[model samples]
Target: MTAEKTDTLIVGGGQAGIAMSEHLTDMGIPHLVLERNRIAERWRSERWDSLVANGPAWHDRFPGLEFDDVAPETFPPKERMAQYFEDYAKMIKAPVRTNVEVKSVQRCAGRPGFIAKTSQGEIEAQRVVAATGPFQVPAFPNIVPEESSITQIHSSNYKNPDQLAEGAVLVVGGGASGSQIAEELMRAGRKVYLSIGEHYRPPRSYRDRDYVWWLGVLGKWDEIKTQAKKKHVAFAVSGYDGGKTIDFRNMGHQGVTVLGITQSYKDGVLSFANDLAENIKEGDIAYLDVLREADAYVERNGIDLPPEPEAWDIQPDPSCVTDPILELDLKEAQVGTIIWATGFKFDFSWLDVDAFDDKGMPFHKRGISAETGVYFLGLPELTNRASSFIYGSWYDAKYIATHIGVQRNYVAYQKEK
Candidate 1:
């Protein structure tokens, strides 16, 4: 209700924010964590109805927090993850105020702090940390027109197969969201048109254990220490056809029509690039590359793991090449729904600061912003490939929080001297 002053201002109450809050609290610093909606708002609303946490619960927990009383191996659904965040916030007594949206975060012109204008009121703080996370704005490509007549759904708004039209669905993008949605639609007995690009079909499990288990043991995630390798990380396996594997190795046999990347849509005709076959080939290459890395890790560490199962053949189906859709008439194809699983973009327009780059991207080394009192967390490739991931976010938060606390306390101590 009133303008409150704090030592630090946290702009989100998600995992990163709460993690940092715990650190700041232990450091005996006054801070406030603000969320526009409920904590874990994206997990609560933006996700599809049937969507589950892409990773297992055991590996997803943050520092000082674990999924207690819950099955560690279970892949939790959207609501469950949301509740986990809510419960975690309560468990730690994080100073989170939900429904308070930050409108702008501006540096105090001649001062050593920031002023955050919010829907609730203006708050002043010596340090401001943005933990808003990635996946904020839905990215729709220019290829898709805005005035199209048929129904279009961004992957964020999608819930389940029942929400789609009674006609065929054309899913654009072949990454995790696209592949998962296409498989879901197909399982519901709907004709699915999948637009393919470079994708990886990493097996969910390898050699009697979850693939992530091997990653943990081999320190794969930690090996990704630079931004150069972050872009190459493959998406999670969609347990569609194979209950435990990706099964994209047999995409052509999955009863879904594969197409090239959507290039343009005009006059009821959608044009696609002639790169469908090439993309599929690239996917095979990615799969092999990833498999080799895993195998090499196991061998180098003298990990005498059991050999890959005899029944689990990762060999690509010979029928990968079928009729690729170069272009299609919307009316003739009878496709009525267009789903855009094109990924996300970030909008930091509200953070009125010159520390941002020409493209409005915040300039930060790790999580510390270019401006001394400002910081950013929960960004992809911030420090490592996992910087944006829940498991990796806490590390960034901890470092940033520690820096802010030492700097704030030192500044205060200087005044006393």
Candidate 2:
């Protein structure tokens, strides 16, 4: 195998990887991006045909180009987004080595650089960026019984509603993916069951105002202020929010049954929490109560309100109850399809880096990791709203590129002792 060398090497050619490539090109940094498949292949292959970005087009766009200037407010379809990424690569003339799967990435041990072993060959680089992001591995619940005759499939494998088995379909997650899948299946005339977890659910719009617009007002657009409030905001905004939420009011109209947590699936009998919505609704009510208290406190303390409404409150329907997960004996219900929308997991076994946290996430301060010459991008809360989103990835990429440039400059100054 021939050994190649570059100043910077990027793993994965997805949104994050492509953004980094663009940044490197702009900075005149000699780099190569290694992708196991064609650019944006993951999105192209994994996403369903009707899949649309939860975020608006403007927010979903990358750094250099805007997606559809006229309809920037609308969410772009998956295929269009894929095309946009492909066009981004061509526009920047990014140096990419497609079909090169990186088997392992390790420090040079005694050397100043790192070695990347790939299917094609070996490459050495002074700097490496693991832009693989999350969702590399699909997370499934172990509570699912092995003896069941039902066909189980992760959301990654699900394409269309027709692919699901006939009978009541139980979707195992309540997040964006699960909600959308459940809606789709229900629209296709299937009895859909949605298991509601403690997921984020934001209003689709606030008094005719888009949530993205409010996000800007809430300091989600201001990087410094947002980062400063991360500790306080982390817990509140950790789960899925913003556009990921489904229109629950319409979900009932569409004939989708929302249930609580799945306790167990044994003997073809699926049991769930009886009072799933009670806790969830109570939490929502408590949150609203807190908001009301905070508003009163602000008024008492003579705190000036921001431009938006200061005391806005939402009254959830007290009568609404999420249906309990019926104990369906596999033999009786004969349910065929079990879609686990349980969420995603990260796999980092290949990249032997010491910067990972206990959850296997790379420990980085605004995309710059502890290990010098290494960075992470396209992760939730990495910096701010842009951290996990495509638009956010560009911000992370720019910061990382600047850091790399600074490191390269310092390397130039350092001399062998």
Candidate 3:
């Protein structure tokens, strides 16, 4: 069968793909967007029942669009966010084809363009953008013993506390998802054990400004990934509970047993590292540093903001440091569930191109891949710290679209010559 043709073919109909389609449309570029499922499928299906966007509504949307009737300072629920994206796509009139799974994207034989094989059929395109984003695979650690009796579920499949077997829960990972899930389980009157890891602890709000706002004003959001000095895999913040600081210490006080980094499960017992105190101290330092930076920024810019609250400077006592539960027998603790809040991994195996690094990530300089005419969008640190955030989509899409336009124009000039 003859393949359908287009100037550009965008893979994945999530926020990233839709953003790319919108920009390409604005530039009068003829393109097609292919989605395996409905648009914003992950936001609708993969997220937990109580999940809300990590960023506030004001800072989480594309340019010139505000979340419908939602407070700027408040975070939108997962359902609301999914609807917002669907509405945004409709408003832009993006040429998106849902339920069309792209099988592979490869360079055409003796040709400059690419041929994309999809479930529906085949398509030839001058350019391609892999906007599949990062949350492709649920990353569960190898440490968990498969022979163990306890039931396990990754954060991606986790829906609600009622779905789990009746017993204590061991939530592995100190990231945002894990921390939130652990807290939710504890509040549900379940004995919860949270394994802490190297994660950032930033206040949800400082001086009446959201944490994301500070990151933007401080210019931290625009910092390139490679040049970044320190990076934390996850931030501890809860948007579901009206944007609250996720303090493991407070969680401990609320009856959740917070442990150190998970080591391994041996003979039905789980082992943990002895760095609970150190983790707390590190998080404390980061918390103070952010507040201090905010203070300095206010003074330097001569901006009127609220003074730092006295509670902000207070550090909790590291009670979990001295007598940390380094080991626990799954049966003895009545732990019936092991929830892996270990985050997600990216999969680019569908793209048969010589543009990946050792980790299978595309070698791209801010979405422009080493393989010409192949671009990546919505990956972590693709351009800046904000590259994966909802607000970052607009800027990254613009950059990718501009490159496509320039390349197309240059090719046309070469043909004329």
Candidate 4:
């Protein structure tokens, strides 16, 4: 079949892809965006029912559009967030083709461009941008026994309390998703046991302003993703209930059995690491670090923000640290559900290009890859700390689109000469 052609081909019609299309359109660059499913399919279907945007709507939107009917400080539900993207696509008139999956992207033999094999048909382009953001596949540890009777589901598949079997729940991974899900289950009257892991504890709001705002003002959002900072996986905070800090210490008082890291499972008994106290201390250190940073920023700038609250006021007694559940028997504890909120991983195996590192992650200077005509977007820290967020899409998209336009213009000039 004769492959369809465009000046540029963008993969994955999510916020990143659409943002790229918007910039390309503005620069008079003829491009096509291909989505495997509907626009923002992950937000529409992949997310849990009660999930909301991690960032507030005002800060997490495309600069060209604001979320209607959503308060500035409040996080919009997944449905509203998806609709906002759909509306933005229409508003910008992006040439987006839905239900088209790009199976592979490779250089055309004896040619100067790329040929993309999609579910619909082939498409050739001078440049290709892999905008498929992270969170493609749900991941879980291989600790669960294959023959266990307990119902197991990843956090991505969890909907609500009624979806799980009636009993206590063992929620693995104490990242943002795990903490939030564990809290929700506890509130729903389920005996919740949250397995703690290495995670940061940034407050949702501090001193009358959101932590996101503080990060922006303090110039932390633009900081590049460094190797040392990568270990700080996620912040234990929630946006659902008016955006509050997710302290496992406080959660324990409210019925969540905060335990240490899930180590192994055998014969229906799960063993936990005896580092619960250390984990709590680590989280406290992180939490204190953020507060100290905010305080310094306030003092240095002379900003008239509210005074910092006493640490004891916000921090609850870390009772679980001294008395932790080191082991749990599934049958004895009546724990019938194991929710894996470990995290998600990305896949870039389809690209037949030498643009990746030893870890299979695409290595690029900003969004431009070493391989000519290849670019990437929406991956965390692709350029800066904000590169993975909704707001990050604007600048990354503009930079990539502008780069493509400049290269295309130079080629045209050479041909004319």
Per-model CA lDDT versus the true structure: 0.78, 0.72, 0.88, 0.87
Runs in model 3 deviating more than 4 A are 224-227, 414-417
Over the stretch 60-163, how does candidate 4's per-residue lDDT look in tens digits?
89999987798999989999989999999999999999999889999999988999999998999999999999777898888987678988889889989998
lDDT at 412, model 2: 88
How far is 77's C-alpha from truth in model 1 (Å)? Answer: 0.9
For model 3 the local lDDT of residue 104 reads 92
TM-score of each model, paired residue for residue:
0.92, 0.84, 0.97, 0.95
Q: How close is candidate 4 to the true structure, as a TM-score?
A: 0.95
Residue 332, candidate 2: how far off, in angstroms? 2.8
Candidate with more favorable, higher TM-score: 3 or 4 = 3
Model 1 Cα lDDT, one tens digit per residue, 1-417: 566799899988887888788778888889999999999999989988877776778776776667776677677777888888888888878999999999998888787788899998899888888888988899878775778778888999999999887888999888778888888898899988888666666667666666667667666666644534436333646533333555454655877887888898889899988887777667666556666767787788887778774433445543434556677888788888999988888888778876787778889898888878889999987877678878789888788878987797678775435
Q: Residue by residue across 1-417, what tens digits does model 3's lDDT show?
A: 999999999998988998999999999999999999999999999988999999899988888589768998888999999989899899999999999999998999998899999999999999999999879999988886676788988999989999999999999988789998998898899999999877788888888899998998987788634555566456777785887888888788778898999998888999999988888878888788888889999999999998868737654654565589999999999999999988888788889998898777689898999999999999888888788888787789999999999999988885435
Q: Candidate 2 on 68-117: residue-level lDDT in tens?
A: 54276677777787888888998999998789999998888888888999
Best by TM-score: 3
- Candidate 1 regions exceeding 4 Å error are 224-227, 230-236, 239-243, 309-320, 415-417
- Candidate RMSDs in Å, in order, are 2.5, 4.9, 1.6, 1.9
Model 2 segments more than 4 A misplaced? 221-245, 279-323, 414-417
